[model samples]
Target: MRLYLTKAALLAAASLAAQPAFAQESDDLIVVTGAPAPIAIENLPAAAVVIDVDDARVRGDISLDQALADVPGLQVPRSGPIGQQTSIFSGGFESNHTLVLFDGVRIDDPSTPESVFDAGQDTLGDARSIEIVQGPLSALYGSGALGGVVNILPRRGGEGALNPRLEIAGGSFDTLTANAGADGTLDRFRYALNAEGYTSEGYDIVPERIATHDGEKDGADITTLTGVFDYALTDSLAVDLLLRQREARVDYDPGIFGNIAENPGSEIQSDTALWRLGASWALSDALSLRLSGGALETDRVSSDFGVAGDEYHGDRDFADFSATWSITPEWTLLLGAQNEDENIEAVSFGSPVTGEQEHWGAYIATQGVLGPLDVTAAIRQDDFDGFGEEFTWRAGAAYPIGEAARLYASYGTSYRAPSLFERFVPFYGNAALDPERAETWEIGGDARFALFGQTEGLELGALYRASEIEDLIGFAGFAYGNVDRAEIAYAEARIALRPTDWLTARASYANTDAVNAATGVALARRPEESWSATLAAERGAFSGQISWRQIGSRLDTTYDDFGFWAGTAEVESYDILRASAAWAVNDEVKLYIAADNVLDETYEPVNGFAGAPASLLVGIRVTP
Candidate 1:
């Protein structure tokens, strides 16, 4: 890890030292995705990252986890991609700090044990694009947007006539997959459908100390289905609907030193469903209205091995309803509200008895724009059956300096309420734990400019973020406790240049500084610096990318100096390397290959789980 950091720093320094120094290109680029009008990046106070479908295709054999690898000041730990959890962090908060959304709808359960939802698995295989906004966003999105937001836009509407595709893949551990999709319009009704299924005999995720650790490795199988439909009425009004369902079965294997009798075998199966109905109506030549409403549901169960001795089950349901009115050419207003309900039940590890809890909440928000400036403000008030009421809020603004550059800033209050698990875990939950609160501020801008002799364009941007947190719920002295405060400061920058008509080069760097105010200690295992660089080029029918990434040292939460677990120590700081490529055989067919740990650097990012040695994968995509 030390060597990796040194090399990365040197490389960054070198890039900075040799720059010819050119101002970013400022232009009238449309920014319709985040706000009502087509604003430029420099005009919005919230720092954001956007990845389009074209960028996604040329970036190697996309490992869903790797797709998020380059986002500045962000962390997406990998347990071999596809099926693992990808936690998002901001201003030094945990995974739950960020909000993951699908078409502006939150996909998480604020009423559950772990308030944050894992969107990596659902969006990776069929996404059209992804946008990430860094900083507090309670004004635009309400609670759970404290760290930031990752919104996925799935692929829809294919050009020309009907288009269809199929894909299949197989790799180590008997991992297998099949994906199929189609897009077409019938009688003025355009629609798209995507479906995928995959299974894997996963590598062991347990620590190395247990005797039976090898076979105790866990595995997972998942299937997902999605569809989008749209219809136009009278050429001025349109209705749209979206539906999705995901199912997963995961087997458990406690690591190397775990005792089977005490830990036991475990399995979990989960089902998630979502639906939305909305319409876009033109009220006048200059006025318009967009309305939408949707609902989401999830069901999950965790059992001991295959036995039902003591089971853990949870369910979450939510509704999203919002209205947008284009008040004028330069200004618009949005009013929206959401309602959520959740429930959980669990039995003991060896007993069949059960215990349960229920929770619910609601929230609203509004945003508008004035010429080159835009503003957003929102608030959310939630009510937990036992916890009563809690509120979160935010406000922000953006100003365009030129057609190609903009300046933006924002301030907001966000929060993470105790998850059901955090508040009620049999042996872990603390009844006295308080809901975590955060006050955050952000500033940044994006600029576009000519590059490589002024023949092509380049995009450059940077963001600085800081936050102060209160009542952080954590564990201390074998019991749950609320740490009075925590502080975090972070920064991220990105550079993407189209040096030639057929080639693109890009790089990103990020740094995070965090401290536990109460203990006057810096959290371990939180990498201080991280970076990624890639060069992609294309010719004829072939395209490929060479990429590199490094993660700094992090502290282990399981660290213990006591004699009881002596010599069974943990290590900090590890680095990894991976590379991938692909080729287009025809307009509707393509083939790809990927190699993880290309240099085969051997080190563990997470304790116990031996990162995979160098591995290979080959797959084919067929579209007709």
Candidate 2:
């Protein structure tokens, strides 16, 4: 079946490309995460994918996790349903290996064991675009870039004189949602603001463990507010400010294999806040300077049956200073410095713990464009308070084959530093743990042509990535220790086609092999095979989309009766289907409906945990 599907996709692509060539305007999209300043997408030598707000609205997706699941070589693991613990894995690496940024500020929680970012706590209502860069990028972004980087760009003002949008939605499980926003420009000042609220009476995730109870349901409520302000002092200088906050309360079931009868209720309350201030000045026609500073604060409280609760608090601050100089029309140089400070406090089972850490880094990079060839190289050095210093580097090249084709290749190295919780926690801390390291290389190409008498876009790419870590930290004998070495290899293929102005299609397949070098056992939750596809179209005032995703079988571990020893088990494969449609009633009003899990497939993304069933949602949006 897989072979047949692959062949069909290839045939379709070939047929589309065989048509006559037609003149069309070139794509002018700009991406900011690949370098010190915004650069055209065609100039980037790395594998990157960009999803805009219109794409999410057409697909009826409300969260970042759902919007990113269709990207190639990416996996999202959820503990239960929406508003649950969520993690993203890239190239078979753990969640912490990927760096997440909100408006250019890092969002990793210092209180967590691995400084992982939770995607479930926030919605996508205020986002303008999302950029995903696949591969090691420690040379550009500091630590926590071992796998890749995800950057969320917020909406800004200045597009029009005045703009406002409002939306309301309701769905299965008694869920309700409402959001409103506005943006505009006045004189030298431009501003944007947004607010959102959501609530749901969710379903039980671990039915077998909670079946003895009387129809117990887990529920959740969330609220978010965001604002952006920018002022242009002159044509050569500007100032910007951003603020965002989120509050959430979520109820969840007990552990999958645990005896839920004893624990009646489990819930968590969390609050996250982010703030940033930045300025840019064009010192000369060929020289520019940029400076930015930001802070991220998080607080969380968790409890079971109104007892045995834990409280966690984390605060982090960061600053960046950079200068870019254009030596010639073909060459450019960038130099930057960064600093970060983090503090964490935790109270678990009446025991209190606190820790702090600091880091400093500096980097230099150069990019050159000569004729049809583009080349870039960068190097960075980072120093940790207790871990000394580490260095990383990257190099990439791209060459245009013709007016409508290009070939690119890149090689880079990245790392992930141990978190404060991993080094200073009471009983399960390991101060001797070393930072995880990774290296990756990739090559790919793309082409553009005409199909069905209209201009069309087509891209095909492939990549291979391998990573290894020394002194890997794990739990052993009720204590954290550097017990094993781990390695992983991943390969992926991707295809994207736009046959017309209103039609788009995409398909991707990935295979991963990961194991502990000492035990020779496969890594848990790393599937060997995974595939996804999406088809979308729009005509007149109507738009629709259909998506499919599948995951292959993998190995998992289960604890014994006393929850002490571990044993391996096999998890069956599963597939899902979803569809959505939207109609624009007029210039100011639009209606939409979506169906998730249309086939009602029963499968578990995580072992022993039940997934969501078929559900429906309807919404109306108004803009003026």
Candidate 3:
């Protein structure tokens, strides 16, 4: 589609490459998840948000979910506290529809029944930023991206000098935590390493108000290790390596016989590791090529005192290659291919079951100035073992309004293939199920302006997006099947204020209207309305931040034990407030304290599961 194809529009877009999507907070804030390469926030016709996890230790954040609680339309739904079963609901899309990436590698689990990633279990260990790109992005990434992508970018070494850091904390609920990391650079190599561990007695997640509820507190013990190395073998070729591993033992309620959702002896122990090796080769002055290969291993076991336990093991091997041709200063072309193989096995009641899946994909894309608009177009073809072949395409354009404002729109198609566990799990599986396909379109704009006495910043951002999915997978009376179609419409309004350089404030309101086409009922666990706000300030050596969130009611279906339908359950709305304050004792040391659920409101986002309660933590850091 043409983007205001006029001579004036042409002049406007000629200098629109560097405008900020919301505000010019930093001229060097780079976002890499929106496209194949780093593109300006305003140049792409997609919606994206970047959340920084700087100094997480000083902020008393144990996991990445705490840093993401302020995101407008991204709802973190957890069955309990940290290390529990948790996922995110994005833009009213299904929980499993959101794909996650560590650096740039896919991390979706293949062993889980729904093939979903556990966002709650991932801790913020040496991460620099987290980027969220909204809408269907199947043209760039294949399955499990029907809603969007979440990429966690870690800090790298070799920038300049060597630095070392250590932190320790203890707080309410018998919690203890520690972190250590160092960054350094050598002759032609740079390296970074980080390790963190946490243990807590944990508060009880089963409320005493419910019948048959066990008052035993659920607890968690977790540890994470990260290593990154980069070597400049030559001027034209460079190699990099990444290794990450996490091990956890989490206690949870199993909702045993006659109990709403509690069991004293239920627990799970899991271990996961990821490793990747990548190299970039510049073949010529205008052409470059890149290649990477990686593998992920997962092992987990769950059980209760008197019940049968289950064990699961999964493995995934993946390889990717891409080429970039810089045709000119304003135009470029990208070609890429990806292949992945996954295998999983499970032991239930002393019976071992196994499954496998494979997929290959190739894509091409072009981007540059066209007529009066900056535009992009891409197409991809993916082949899966059971689903045969599927194709997806996307196109978008942006029109700038002089140097202060811009408008953009995009449309794309995406799909999700049936998981191996969904098709090979005993009598509950359905091998005949087909992949779910969907299309999405969005139009949004943001501007930069000055308020009070501040520099370039944003006053407002308006966005509206919609998606329609076909052949949604669901449970029938006998087995899983393609049950219904779903329609989703979302809109958000945001305002940011910078009264001065020392203080800032932001607030946003979002509405997600999603329903099933057949029954016209709202989707389960997708909140209809959400609100978020944050305020931060700095004075001398003291800094502080405050955040608040509100979520609306959600609807879900409850089922009986005999594989039969029961009734609908409504989850009520609630709000929470959190705050943090830090003080610099000197240039090499700092002290901080954080409080959660400051108002002490008691409510559950999910039925029968208790939310986190009021707690406080104090910590100290040493940097050299």
Candidate 4:
């Protein structure tokens, strides 16, 4: 693996030195969902990344978090298989500080008492595209958007007659997956449907009884189905409808700290159903109106047998409405409101703490463009029954430099209410915990240039961001409370190039310095520095890529057997290398091979956890 990475890096250098002559192309494409108006990447002032559907498809069946694992500015603390928590730092907020969406709909989990869950769900297989804007987003998305927003774009039907796809894969660790989807248009309407199933025996980072509790039995199984409908009512009117359902059964082994004590088994089952209805009307060429309404329902149950027996059951309903108007060619306004009702019941089969609580919030945004620049501003006031009203806001701007390049910048504020686990879960819940609040700021830019006037493009981007948090929340001594404030600064850069029709290359580097500003302590699950690079070449029906990723040392805090505390514990870092290739036998079939942890690096993303060993997979795809 190391040899392959060295070869790829050398090849990239050679390509740069060769400076092969090729054609040059130029164009300016504006980006929305981040800045107020569409602005070219080169002139966009903030640090952002866009992964289109084509790129996503080429990445195969990897979870969205795994596919983006090496992105310089992002941090994904992988739990196992499809479960991970993805968080971006503007200053130093956790995943709860980030806001995530699917096709403009908030996808936060309703099972955890708070509408937030681990970032794992955001990686559903139906995603067609993903956009990441790193900075404060309070003004645009309201509270809980202090770090950034990640939007997953769904695949909608185009003018084509029909599009269909199928994929199946199996590998070691008892992992298996199957996916199928289709999109088509019929006269005045278009429709899309997708379904997927995934299961894995899972590889334990910590052996079942050796660690803390029992780490050997950690694994997951999940299934999902989605449908989309769109219709053109008239030349000036259109409507869209979306429905989705998900079910999951999960089990994990919690490691023991010292000697074997108890073998507590956890079984969790969850289900979610959601629907969206929307309409768009064109009042004029320069003005349009869009109205959308959505509802979500979720149910979850978890049972832990033996040791610390516990059971949890919960249900939630959410409704939201929003309107967007294009007042002019370059000016847009958005107004929206949301309400959620949650009913939860939890019992510590042995502890004697059983309780339930109910939670709800309403939000607004405006954006415009001026000449070569775009600007956006937004605000929201959330009224929690017990916590009172809290407000958040954000402001951002982007500018285009020339035809192929841009810059972007933004600042925002955010806040998070305590979750049921933190506020009311028996001994673990600290009703006295304070709400988490934060302020984040960021600025960045990117540039595109021809390599020796070659048609193959070379692009470079960089960003600097900082954040400060107050009244942060965490678990300590089996209770939740307001922790010390935190501050973080991060900087990163990336360079990507396509040296030839058959060759592509990329390199990235990042530095993050996060501290508990009040206590001067380092943050958890964060690396001080990280780097990655990849190179690939394709010819005719054959293509292959080799890549390498590295993470720096990290720190974790844990309580000792004495029930005291351990602080700033150190963990070693490690590197991983991977390679993959494919052969298109014909239009109807293809054969592919992939390998990970080629070096079998003995390291964990988290302390005392199991990391992937060297493994390989071979698969085939068939299309009619």
Candidate 5:
């Protein structure tokens, strides 16, 4: 069984690195997607990661790509199992070159064709954290941030009492889940709310193909809701509001290439909505002002059995304005303006299409601290009515190397624009595409000391990234062009440990080399090595976690025997393990248990699907 799960994950990492370390203390997190406010995380200079909500409640992660699958130059993938369709590749670009946000709006999907953003329809109840910044950010989010940016930070409420929560869960194909929430703060107003639901009965994501007899299976159902509101109106003003929604129905199976007909009643249904409004003003204490606006909508339907297949509608409206000047205390400045509009309607075979696009942007940025370094720079310009102009820039630096290390470097430029179903879909639209530029560079560092001699605390990090992608939109001889060009390089490493005071550990690694510099191939499902490890523990109220992940072999794209497009194949390598536990049957109750693919190792991340197996879950939670 893979050598007994690699000797039980090296004996649980050598018994958590041979225990015996104490004095644990932690908390040094603050991030805002690496800029535009909130900082710290070692002064953030890109290459970031956060994942809060207590790390998705100690790893019983549900969606958001299983809580970003051990982030580190991320690559999610997944085309089968739970809610199916998920993608998020970074550094190697593609998957719409990253960029996804929630609290601050923008959630791709402009009638697809690369307007990506679908982490299995995201869910982490009311989130509260999830940063992930990595590399190119289109000079502060614009176009699809070349290869990084994921925000999702919801849950907010202030002042005092009133807090409530509830949860329930069930497992193994025939899964179920439920959640509820509440938040507080009265004086000057503040609030938060959440709701969630899930259902599953999935399996047979191509169950070893058998020439298709569609034994039907492949299920999902989901629902979610979130809300937040804030108001101050004094002490320098404040106002904010947000709302979110999601709905889904999924099931699938049909093509695993060539012939293999057995539709088994395909399905897909979706709905999404988001809204935001905001205001903040300080105008002193180094000056400040902020404004925001947002909207997002998505609708979809696809069916096969009960007829009617294909229909989509998408929309987005956005606005933003910003200002900040801390012209002292080591200087800072930022300025911004943005607007976006997108619309789409699509229907299949019986034909029907509609499209719209609009964008405008302006930006400027600066940050400072000189002796011992910390610097940042930015620039942006965008205007795209018909894909006309674009400009992006970024610069970064960070240095510390003293009180427990820091060092960083960055360079960036990005762009993506080209999705209105790749420019008006009708016989495969193409209004003369353009806009797919990129350039990136990154360097990393991280350190934090005190290990073993007690006072536990350890952290280490490393990163290196490279990129090049020029006008690379694909799909030839039948529209959607800009032909191809791409190149990518990657390296990442991470470690975090706490040694005592009840365990904690983490590890990560990545090594990728994407290609396709115009047909040299190798970029399909990307994976040139990947890794992950995790362990968590808590005493006095019981808690637990264990995790492992791996992916290596890659390359996919096959289909011959009349289905055309025949070529690459190789999608081997795989490993996964998971476990979870919780108990706090006291302070308002809690109980949990979870297990997933604990060695039911059958792999296929794409290429004929089928991946997820061995599952179990049980849960309960309540708070007051």
Candidate 6:
């Protein structure tokens, strides 16, 4: 411990000597997903977290799960490595309860077993920013947000000359990656494009001890492309376009399929295509109208023994219109409506079954300064063709405590309509299921204190959220049903301290308790305790970071020795360490190395599925 502390001291001193040449960056994280318009993070009454993708890339986080692993009250359990299925359980709610949006468009697939977004399938190479709003948000986003909302903003074209970026590399597991991006402006026209391809000869995510056959070296790969274009016709009118395509494939060791071996040439393939067009007009200083329409098509296929077993396809088409009225400098009102059509088809044993649904929703929100308090309120009415009517509302207030601190509280109601697959599938589905509903409230505050100078930003925040969910969908008597109630609560604390101009330390901790209200069974994958800490340093031309994360014990379903179905059991707690270093060779070039799971701790994230082992990667990036 003495040696480590002494070495760190010396490094900090050296880095600080060089830091005078490079200034600390300014913070410009104005979040939009939480409100009708962009607002500063500190002004938000609800607990929210915003992440910059550039920072994530520098820290060697390629996927969304890797980047969000440290977020409080969020759990991302990957069944395997890259390309494997991954799901998010936020605030102890189901995966489908959390809504995800990409470039302001919904991308969740309705054909999946749970009708949720696969957080693992896409890479964050093209994302510019991510906003995470914790607690219920269906009042603003409509259904499918009983837990929270995750919004990802793609890169936009910048003004002036073109900027191009390219990177190619290969590392452990015979992994290979290639990335390219370009953005520029041309008079009234602006455009941006990004592409990424990644492949890996991955090890068996399923351990031999729990498998029914010999382990096999699974392989996984993904390719994605995104494009954005904007044009201005007049000072008051503008148009924009967005296009995206993603394809992925992963080999898996399916456990005990009717007495069949686990690693029997099983694989899953998926493809997604999405596009959107939008137009905005400013009628006057007080009113602005925005309209957008988009479509998404997604499909998945699972194969074993060289034959396709099941195929699922889902499609969504939607149009949205909103008018923002600035009644006063300190007050605003936003009125919006959405029309959507979703369809799903599943082919099981060569028999195809299809289902379609329509959703219509209208919402109104107000944001203003009521006296010394920042206040916001919203209400939404939704009509599902298959179901009846639903209503939700949200209200929040923030009170300033002097210049550097604020106290905030929020209360909201949210809901999630059952998916097509969950309601109309073969024997496991129930057609009479009701929508899952939840009510949540939170209280939090933030304070900022400067130590040495502006470079040393010492910030602290803490929050506690309590929630109750009713009619939660659960598997009962061989079919899915809304027969359970649940309670969720979490206390989160965060700190970011810069003791020196060149050194920064950050940490977050969360203690969550989620359980079934009826039976008192703990929710799966939602750990009772978790924490993460990181130490980062930057100098004139060099930067480095070391991170430590820990996941606490939780109850998850276990399997039999032959990989057959079993009951729930307690899972052990585990910890992981990661480190990365980067060197800027010149104005437009950088070299870096990163190590994951440095201690090689053998742990299972989801029940019996094995997590990834220690790995290394080195790469160089060029921007010209």
Give all candidates' CA lDDT scores. Answer: 0.60, 0.73, 0.76, 0.62, 0.73, 0.77
> Model 3, range 81-125, lDDT digits (tens) per residue?
788878878899998898787776777778887877887778886
Question: After TM-score superposition, what is the CA distance of residue 143 in candidate 3 from its true location, in Å?
Answer: 0.4
Task: Encode model 2's per-residue lDDT on 352-430: one tens digit a residue.
Answer: 8688889899888778786777777788899987777889988877777766666777788888888888888888877
What is the clash count for each candidate, in the order shown?
26, 0, 0, 30, 1, 0
What local lDDT score does residue 73 receive in model 2, on the 0 to 100 scale?
A: 77
Query: Candidates sorted by TM-score, descending order?
Result: 6, 3, 2, 4, 1, 5
Compose the digit string of candidate 1's lDDT tens values, residues 442-518. Answer: 88777778778654368877878889888877677676678568888888788888867788888888888877877
Tens digits of per-residue lDDT for model 5 on 1-624? 000011111111111101100111125433221123333446555556556654475456778887887676677878777688888888667888888776546677788766887888676888766656667878777688888777666777644757888888787888887889888988888888999998887887764544553556788898999888878899887877788888998877655454434466878888888877777788777776777777789998888786767788889887777766667766667677878888898885567878898888877777776777777777888898986889898887778777777777888898888888878888877977998998988888878788855453787788888898888887889878888889898888888788786887888888889988877777888888889887888899998888888878888875443334456886677888998888888999888887887888877676666678778778787876
Residue-level lDDT of model 4, residues 1-624, one tens digit each, is 110111111111111101110111124343332122333334334555456543443434356666556556677766444543333433345757666666666566644544454555443457666656556655445446667666666666655667787877777777777778888899889988889888877665342323353435556788888888889999988888888888877665432443223333765666777787777676765544555666666665555663334545555455555555667766766665666555555554354433344433545566566666767666777766556677887776777777656677777787776665566666577776667888777787777788845653797878788888898876565667686788889888888897776787989898988888977878886778888999987899998888898888877553343323455586777898988888889997777777888888766565444566777666666654
Runs in model 3 with CA error above 4 Å? 1-39, 55-57, 258-261, 306-308, 348-351, 557-566
Model 6, position 162: C-alpha lDDT score: 95
Between prediction 1 and prediction 2, which has the larger lDDT? 2
Candidate 6 regions with alpha-carbon error over 4 angstroms: 1-40, 211-215, 258-261, 349-351, 452-457
Largest lDDT belongs to which candidate? Answer: 6
Rank all candidate structures by their lDDT, best first, as comma-separated numbers. Answer: 6, 3, 2, 5, 4, 1
lDDT of 6 at 246: 93
Worst 10 residues of 2 by lDDT: 1-10
Between candidates 1 and 3, the one scoring higher on lDDT is 3
TM-score of each: 0.83, 0.90, 0.92, 0.84, 0.33, 0.93
**Higher TM-score: candidate 1 or 2?**
2
Which candidate has the top score in TM-score?
6
The residue pairs in collision within model 5 are 158-185
User: In model 2, which runs have C-alpha deviations exceeding 4 angstroms?
Assistant: 1-28, 31-40, 208-215, 255-264, 305-308, 370-372, 476-478, 497-501, 558-566
